[model samples]
Target: MTNNMTLGQRFLANEWSALAVAILVGLVVLASMSPAFLTEFNLYVMLRSFCVVLIVAFAQMLTLAVGHMNLSVGALGGLVAIAVGGMMEKWGFPVPVAVLAGLAIGAAGGLINGLLTVRTGINGFIITLATASAFTGINLGITESIPFYNLPAGFVAFGTGRLYALPYLLLPPVLIALALAFFLARTVPGRQLLAVGGNPHAAELSGIPRDRVIVMAHTLSGLLAGAAAILAVAQLGSAQPSIGVDWLLMSFAAPIIGGAALTGGHISVAATALAVVLIVIIQNGMVLAKVDPYWVQFLLGALILAAVGLNRLRAVRAGGA
Candidate 1:
């Protein structure tokens, strides 16, 4: 009986379980409410939407795991979008080369954020916020608010291609999720990153290079943000200056809702993925049910508040236990 009770406690404390349950519940409710919810086209739309958001969520999640936050995820993504788009459109660079360049640019941006934060002893939030502004400035300066419309035929085709109800674009996020889950669960560096976030003092005492780990987290976050930007360009079949404008909220919301600790050290990629699905479901359902588009923002805010409250309650319960 004691063993069973302990297992139950652990289960309740697991964020993945909560998110999984929520996804299942949302699916059932939406499917029942809207006949079109399960249609091939609607399902394809939802899955396609999931791709970029999931990657962006992971970007923020990596920062959260290192006891930091990247306030510039959207800005960084927008910058990368324009960078890659410009390369493809103006320079006439091949898709592969442009993508590699974009990823490198993303890493460099992240490296700058990490270095600035560690060297100045400033909070990452502040550093990222400043960089975010800089990135947006550069993006606007280069494009003057215009977008790149001419992308490679192959790239555009991949973005729009589907197999039954599954989108070809879904493959990247799935692979990324698996890679991340493995990195976090099975790798030494991954564990060290978590250690730093969970307890910096302890991590330092144990010989982990705390500063390096923090920087690595930010760098990885930037890289992921860049990848998401590339995917966004593909999905939209154009590179818009506003590519990541709305990503900041979703970036934070999905991870937090999926059980990432704001204080750092804990996050679940799978859970965050599920949280994105839930958000997508909510947005799609709103359209199906004819809910006002403005209400979507309100609902998203409410969900974030609810998730935070629930996390606090869970923390209190664990403390009492």
Candidate 2:
């Protein structure tokens, strides 16, 4: 009985519980209102949408876990998309090679962001904000706001391929979520990263090499952002300069709503995944309900504000307890 109560309490305390309930409610309401909502094609579209957003959410989640923010996530992703697209179209590089190169570029960009933040004593927000501008400028310069239209057939096929009702694109985020869960829960470096986020001074005193962990977090964030960019390219069958333009909000929204601490050292991969699902559902619901396109931005902002407020309340209650 004691164990059961403990488990129940833990579930209630988890941020994912609220999100899960919301998702269930959304699904029920949408399905009842729209006969097309649960159709195979609609379900596939929703799952496909989840692929890129989930990875982007994880990218921001990693930075948040280190008590930092990467305002450049969307910018970095856009730059990478353009780079890879150019490699395949202009330079005629094979898809695999271009992808590997893009990933490397992303890591390098992240490394620079981390080094600048640590060495200059600048807040990550400012550093990444500056870098975001640089990235956007480079992207615009290269493509002149035009997208790469010609991509490898195999690559484009992967983006559109579905196994029955399941999108092949769903595999990456699921694997990433599992890997992130294991890394955070079991690995020494992951623990160190979380430790630094939880309390940097204590972690430094404990010989955790705080700076290194921070850099690692940023680098991993970049890599994930790059991966998402690539997936976006595949999904769209074109490399648009605007691929990640909207990721900034969703990137922060999913993790924050999933219960990532702003101060860091606390995040739940499972919860984040559920949060993404909920967001996707909400977006889909709006489309099915024929909500005005202009209202989507307003709705997103309102949801984010609600999530932040709820988190603050939870923090206060925990403190009081």
Pick by lDDT: which candidate is best?
A: 1
Q: Write the per-residue lDDT of candidate 2 for residues 150-248, one digit (tens) a residue.
A: 999998999999998799888887898899999999999989989999999999999999999999999999999999999999999999999889999
Kindly give the number of clashing pairs for every candidate: 0, 0
Taking the tens digit of each residue's C-alpha lDDT, what string does model 1 give over 1-321? 224447767777767777777788989999998899999999999999999999999999999998899998899999999999999999999999999999999988999999999999999989999999999999999999999999899988999999999999999989999999999999999999999999999999999999999999999999999999999999999999999999999999999998888889999888898889899988998999999999889999999998888788778767777
Residue 194, candidate 2: how far off, in angstroms? 0.7
Q: Deviation in angstroms for 301 in model 2?
A: 1.4
TM-score of each: 0.97, 0.95
For candidate 1, the lDDT comes to 0.92
The parts of candidate 1 lying over 4 Å away from their true place are 1-11
Candidate 2 achieves a global lDDT of: 0.91
Q: What residue pairs are clashing in model 1? A: none
Task: Output the lDDT of residue 213, model 2.
Answer: 94
How many clashing residue pairs, candidate 2? 0
Record all residue pairs in model 2 with backbone atoms less than 3 Å apart, i.e. clashing. Answer: none
